[model samples]
Target: MASRTTSWAYRPSLDGLRMLAMYLIILFHTQVPWIQGSFIAVNLFFVLSGYLVTNVVLTEMERTGRLDLGRFYARRVRRLLPAALVAIVGISLVFLLVAPVVRRLGLVGDAQGSLLYVANWRFIAQANDYFAPNVDKSPFLHFWTLSIEEQFYVVFPLLILLLARSSRRGVMVAGLAVVTVASIGAQVYWATADPIHAYYGTDARLYQLSAGALMAVALRTWPVRLPRVGARAVAVGGMALFAVLCFSAVAMSQSNRGFLGTAACLMIVAGLMLDEDQPLAKALSLRPVVYLGQISYSTYLWHWPAILVMGMFLDVGPVTMAALAAVIATGLAAASAELLEQPVRSAKRLNRFRWRVSAVGVACSVLAAVLVVPTVLEREQPPAVASGTGGAAVGKLAAAHSDPLPKDVDWDRVDRDRGTEQTCQVDDLDRCVLHEGSGAHVLLVGDSHARMMTAMFEQLAKKHDFTLSTNIVSGCPWQENLRNTQSSPKRQERCDEARTGWYDTVLPRLDPDLVVVATLPRDHGKWHQRLENRDGSDLGLERSLLRATRDTLDKIEKVADRTLMVQSVATPRSFVPNDCLTSAKDPDDCVVPLTTTNRPSDAYYLAVAADVDAAYTVDLNPAFCPAGPLCSPVVDGMVVWRDNQHLTASFVAHQRAKVWRLIQQTGVLDALDGL
Candidate 1:
């Protein structure tokens, strides 16, 4: 066989590898069963990119004795930017037409980030959890991979030029090795410390690219010539290993992803080294596979947004969604390839123009996208009316008149009075005192649900003449040494730290007369799905919640004379904010049925509180959802729920008498009076 560097022949097997990687990615995105770990396909692409790009750069350098940076950049811009700009502009237009106002507003930032090729960093800064439930999936999320590749295209060539000037090919190989090691180290560290950031950041993912660069350098400088039988065996075996890893249900984490990256590198190396005549190579060179590979770039670009756009209007099964996504993505990719990509790629005249026209076109489109989307979003906002009275007064006025709804409902500011923005509500476990009374000391402990009640609790604390100290973290349950899997690893670790810090350091320091524990009890499903032990084994939902609830009660009982476990609120099936309700034909349209929601019942809390002596459960569901079958979003014309699960401070203020009575019934006030 002719030397690859000497011949520069198009390798169909490489195209096949690309096709396989693309399919795996599609499968991963589609959430196919037994392919949850197929996100490793991205690692495969990273390696392939490093290899191919490095090979091209090296071949050019070896042939000409110097690199053509201008041509290189123009090639990159022509190949990548046109399709990406099309996707962004196209998606932005669609979002304006079909998406909800809040989602449309968000698209402005997504469009900006994607167009600028910094979306990965944008997601990192936003702390966007890829795996979180009910998260609005960004249509431009797939652009992160493109961003990484584009970034590499910019920096890698410069580095290659510098290395070529300074030393021989061996130095380039060594430099890539160093880069690979450093990047892998960074990946491991960040993956453990902050997995979301690690997953998206270029610093952590650079090693995957470096691995390919190293392979390219090796193949050119010290080409391996294995026996035909050995080459075939290695190629088949490497693919088998890759398949096994990709098909397995292994969790994607820092500890295990290094192995996956290594496996991907091995597969790329084998595919490159094997002859085209080998059975594995021959299968990969098939026409259908090669065509898919040819259109892979545009397919990847369009598939995610296509899925998101389709989902906006259609409620189809996964199979149907996947089919539609494939078809739409393929169609768009073919059009992009034939109409835009191939033409720009072959235009030698445009290359001589140094990508100036392309650059200006991209700049103008991005500027237009940034301006237009936000303008549209701002225009969509409903006009605000100035009202002297608060939501409570407005509620009373609406009740009395029974004519038209009042215009003073500020749904956005519903949680504003909840004191989440207080200086003491830091990310670390710090106590924020919402109310200070001259009587007994009271401490509130739990998660966001606990924080949600602070507004009402502060009012209650003042009414009962007790000081309140709140030690709470959002999304973390008040469970002692218990892991919450639903949250990110960083969050879970922080929760554990906060709990330990409070119990060991803060709790002993602030010995309150009463300790109230509250959390979103409906999160049992999240816990069931996400909670894991230190060893990463599942902590069954019922058992974990039961144990955590009992343990928390026992721990609080030892510190406080009395303990109260506030039952989780009635989580409505849907959240229609007061802003949306203001335009409703009938205000009752905002009412949601209690039976349809998956909130934990009072019985569940009763069972949890049963094991702890003197531990009482306070059910606030009746006050929030007084109507048996239906829970109205508006009670007495004031919005009952600020969002879906949390009560508005104004609504909670109105329910103060009932809540005070419940606290009195628990004898917590009596206990406070004695203290």
Candidate 2:
């Protein structure tokens, strides 16, 4: 049998396809209303990469009867590493110089992962949901896709080389089919079970790449014999369908993986199958479109960081921000391509020094790691303060409204203790006793807001002779059948499961004497103001919230003798307390107005309490806000909030007396006294 050899040609239609995909991604990041499904562009890129790279490997193997692994790796390193290293080093330096310590803390790890081409796995391991609200976007986030491509570049060639001596085409086709099936299966399973992780996982995304590879193999080994008219029709129809899908109301969510992946693969196949002289192909081959496609990689690399940097200082509307981001990204991409990418790619002498390039990349990664040392050390050390003051110093500082806030008070420590560390609260059915005592058993159930009360509750538990058990999940309310509209689908799934498990399993087993429920009402306000829904429907927010809260309280009443519902605290509008304090010359500058409607109203809780006989509403606003026109970030010389709404552990400790009094006034403690 004779092996077949074919020459590769430049396809302008493919370049046009690349341009379209890149622009869609940019628009998605801009967060325009109609382009919600723009994330599918990534799948399109994967398919294109699979087809082009597979075709290259197959052609080379057929012509030479073997693969040159060294040359292949060297080519990949030269093409990708230089621009990537520049971006990583430049972004890291900017962050260290300008960003707040809190924000800079995680960049080192992100940089290291990106440098090693494993950033996707790093993000997945951190449970960093791409759709999370109000969270700062990582500059290295776009590197995840590049990481996947690089992994494919390394592995796919080796596979082809291994099969070169045997019935290569037959075995390769069979292997690709198995891979495609397994990858798709994994995607479907993970999309249902853990969507956020599934979105970033290599296993879930391999099918799209495999689809392209299969198309390449089929074209080479058993070419499609469609009539010219049939081929043109397929190309036109596929392009039309792809455009419709990209612009349609379909959500780019985890559950829609099959549709998204399949659509992207089909688009790539159509682009490949079409003849160059076809009308659609001629349009795609235009000079401007090809130019845009040429710089697509650089555009993708620079756009995210440009947007993030602009967001850090600019207080502009979304449209304005998006426009500014686009301009900056374009300029950077053009400059990078002309000055850096082109010059490096054309330097033939450097191609022989592959080891040197690898070494340089490694050295840059080491520098990034070194840069994060101070932040790591700072996190490990506890805040310096007077011994046995028992939070009195913070109280005094707040009362004085000290200009230079106490340097000894560790704001980060306050944040860490407030359930950000998973150990502080029970997320699943597993019991987490926050504080053990000989007194009555009191269970706290809510989200991070409830976790914020841990220090105060623990103090109260010790003073009032009560034990504390916490069942809390961050960003999750205690309400049943209600989803966090701002969270990713996977997070919502976990929240629902955890809530169901607590209500069904944990509560019944423990049967505590008192149950306390509290969550940040900011989420509830988002539900109402944005009129958001779990499924993105336009439902009646107020009614839905009331029903969910009522159902949750009803469940709690069944398992506990008494229930206490805490009123949501006053959260400043668009203000981060720590950021305010960091730059304040006078502590008074840190104070924000606390208008009656500044925070989310307790209408849902009030409505739920009116119906549930066992549930009693506890208003702590008087103690925290005290009928004030303005609220201070520092209360009694201690930081009142770690961020906007969450209370600092030190401040909460200072208010232990007020919290204990409120718990006693509920008459549940008096009743527990008899027990």
Candidate 3:
């Protein structure tokens, strides 16, 4: 037989943890000095949810010898639906009032995804790039995590039912072990091959949930007994580790896929076992922490969007604004939890009827938001155009509004590329082969960053009468030594072999006048160079990479006259293009001004540039962020960084003239003239 809590276990420590978790997330979103990893609170949450929900189900099964699937589901609906509906409705009203058509479309897409409890899948499919701060601007983005948990609930109850049917203890343990292994294997596979998909896929994330379920089963069968002297110390240590991961960005990037996630699960399990009956637990049960836990859901829902709104509309300092907004949200959420959530949740009468009504209303509101909001915004004004040489009317309008969709764009004509290629076009990922006047005067090599340089070089290529050949791959770097080791065993070897062959074969055959090489900066600490080939033969990756750069430069120098290296440009945040769309009513949801800074540092390219023989270096930083240290995003008449990073295509194209001038000045054309 299993035991159930009295429905009031006074587990204040859990509340304390919840408070800590939400605060970590809140602080991280504020872009506070170094709390870069606060996003991991979502992982902590996943673990807690698995343990608590599994414990609840197992307890009920023990009491009745069967699971109440309907009641369990009903309870979930009652707990989750009301506040979600409120948030959806609130955001909808705000969207209708303030958002432009493009913004409204994005918000509607986000809301529709949330209504179906499939926001995670939508994001993964969109490759939404959640780490970009612009994600917070989506009022419904937090729902992705909610979707993951809800989807887990759909499968987890059945697993519990099957487990409970076991008569033999050995059989039960064996079944759990098998499930644990299989789920973890799936997670590992997904994490490496498709990190974004791994992030949101219910199947890939089941392992984290199962870890909690397994812990619950273990606690049920074999209760942990910590030594009296070491018990408190152990609990504190686990909590501290949890805090470090939640607060430190460096730790976050390292732990994002599998290893850190597993460690978070472990810490959660240890904290749960610290015993709710302990004095520390009683202390955690204090009014403030418990109250926060009670409203944790509302807090999570409110915080991200509130930050977005404030950041977008206000000139207040971000730290102060975030702090003020979190406080206001906490107050509002507490009130909602007390007056709305708890009342509807606790009343049995409202439970059945309200759940159905709430669910239906949420669905309708989301639909209306998707279809109605965009239609209204579009009708209010024509789509805005990007400024270019398109004459006064276009220029005046573009200067009036920073959006680049163009009044005549016909989005239907533009290919969203959903079919075979998925998000980005496959053709875009392939190497570009451009015909020139004659001999190869310049070679562009590296990843996408290197490819972007072609925008400038295209003009110079025509001017200098030299041939331009680019042997570039989307994400693949020109480094001959580093293999694609960030995937599964079989896929890793395959990618490694293909990329390695490209360097050894495709590259050597196209020996150009000057080789321009670039790549995204490698974090030196975790940097691993592939030293062995597929057959286990030593390849000496470092030495080979050095040779590749030197040899290419030497060959280009001999073939023509000059070798020029175009320094890598900075990578910006992804949402900078759409940040200004948030309106006045939800001012808190908009992006703050301070986040706009020059693109990331380009110092890493100096090392590679130094190794090049007879090559002059030109960095694109000044051309892009021409204001020097004060350079910020500019497009049309507004900032182009929707998420305080990533240059919008409109901004890139707008700077075409400046980009062309930079190329002509680099003497790359002169090298081509020599050829």
Candidate 4:
């Protein structure tokens, strides 16, 4: 039972494979729009790493007669830790200082968890919810991959050592094969069950690494010595195949995962096993490609954040055209490698004291991350709560220090009270707040849609010495529950809880002077939105809106005072208001000009307004949606909306003239305004 090292097995072909894998990585991240399947490069690396590391460890144990556990771990620490620490610290700082509310985005989960490599698990928990995917602000989201690799290295070496005790070669080979097979199976099962978590899961990815380890063992025992002609062909064929695999892997849609990934990795390994003396080998081993391979770690670390910052913050064009960005990023990464990575990697230890100090620095980072995330969460407003099941609450609540609502909500206490109900149900928005002041008592109420009008309400309140209040809650239908109680699961439960809570907790508490309710009613979901109409066209949108309007009027009658001021449904715009405004020739002409000859129609809101006006006698729609088919997103040099759908803060603030006058006409805020 001799180790592979004891029995003549060292191959530069593997380095050739590493070269190919890294090249794929470069192309994948480059996302050179033409290179569709570049992502498959990661799979290739996984396979190659699995095979090579396994081979090395098994071979070492068989030949040396004993495993140096401490040295093995120390080597791993030396190879991975310093670079990782530098990257994490550097990225975390960027997020903390440069990015707005970056720490609030959940950069590090509970502090200690991120430092200990359990950030993966924390991500798993968060990612399960639809809203949780982008929750974290950490620039180190990519570190989960490294964490998985490091975790595998830690355990796999120990497993190989144990298996090597009995006929080292036989057990080592068998154990690796068994693990590889099991890992592949797990991948297939979990990928289907929970693709998001499974994709990031270490267990599902182990087989790819094992493939490389197995290759290491096989080459050690077999010794691939090809004739010049044969060697050249193998090498060339492997290289070509590797390139094909890379292209193929990246080109495929993210949906097709299992078979393609396995096949791609296999191709990379075959290429790596080719002859060292072959032309392909000589080319790959050249100083440039080899140097890139050496510094690839830094390249991978910095490339993504560079792209993210450019795309998200700077509003860079499509990722396909991010070449200049990539270039700048690459130069910086290379410089970091030379200045930071190489120094730490090649340095001789000064003393045990220095090592201890470095360890403490690492610990401090985790502590800081933990403390920062919660603080950020506390500062933002929470989402409104739609009515739901009896015992369960729908939205996440912000604790004492963190505001669930934004600061602008505070201009009117009435809005804050309405926001409280909304926040109780949905955790997605900021709760409205009211500042300490002397003013008219104006109340705003409805669903999440009404929350957008806060700026307008606050402006009107300030100008007229009126206090503003809101009755908006998030997620819950301000109109009515469109889903049938018997059919819908989440909606049914939510509606019931909201109904009960509104009647019990909210209704009796706030008897404000005036109420303004806004709602966008619609029936949306799998079957409802897809059903056909009388003329064989889709009438789902129209029907859904109509139903929603009816439900809204019903709810408004229950809570609103004698004179309810209802805003007319404004024409929906599809792009951000400012982007459109900025693109226009003159900022004053901030309107989305209409192409269709017909007047803009919103069936549900119009219907609800018609019914409510007839019953309670108030018309606020003309102030907002007055006149022609064209809807001016910005009126009289003022922007009305921040985004495509909802009213912007600026728009809300400027609505003072129209909104206050409407309230005066209706006599809704007379009591609070001292009229």
Per-model CA lDDT versus the true structure: 0.68, 0.67, 0.56, 0.50
Candidate 1 lDDT score relative to the true structure: 0.68
Question: Best-fitting candidate, measured by TM-score?
Answer: 1
- Candidate 3's displacement at residue 370, Å, is 7.5
Residue 247 error, candidate 4, Å: 4.6
Worst 10 residues of 2 by lDDT: 383-392
lDDT: worst 10-residue window of model 4? 391-400
Clashes (N, CA, C under 3 Å) per candidate: 2, 8, 27, 65
| lDDT by residue (tens digit), candidate 1, 473-496 | 766777665666667878776787
Least well predicted 10-residue stretch by lDDT in candidate 1: 382-391
Instruction: Please estimate how well model 4 matches the true structure, expressed as its whole-model Cα lDDT.
Output: 0.50
Q: What is the descending TM-score order? A: 1, 2, 3, 4
lDDT of 2 by residue, 1-675 (tens): 211213356688788888888877877777665765667788888988888888877777777967767666666777787787777777766555444333444456777788788988987876666653233467788899998888888788877666555675777787788888898899889888877667888888888788888777877776555555665666777776666666638655654744554664565455445455567777777999888888888888888888776654454665676677767777777898898888888888877777676566557656654664334422422222111112212333445343357777765676675642122223443446766778788888787888777778877777767778887777777776556757777866667666754576667777788888888774343465633444344545545555567667777778888788887776664677678677766666666555333122354554344334456667675467542445667665677777766777667778878776666655445456422
Provide C-alpha RMSD values for all models, in order: 16.4, 16.8, 17.8, 19.2
Residue 418 CA displacement from its true place in model 2, Å:
25
Best by lDDT: 1
Q: What is the Cα-based lDDT of residue 252 in candidate 1?
A: 54
The true-versus-predicted C-alpha distance at residue 528 of model 4, in Å, is 38
Tens-place lDDT per residue, model 3, 1-675, is: 222222423356777767767777787677675666666676767777887887788778778988877678768877886787677666656545544333444466677777668888887766644543212246677788899898888778987777667775455556666776787676678767876676677777766767766776766676666654355555566656656665544443432534464565466446545545556556767888888877888888888777765654454655786687679779878888888888877886755564464556456646655775445433332223211122112223333322232333322322221111001122342344454756555666655455444544555567656666665553445555444454457754444543554544444455465666655533222333522334444534433334444544554455544455554454433333233233222212222222222111122222233323245556555566554322343434434332332333334445667876665565554535454
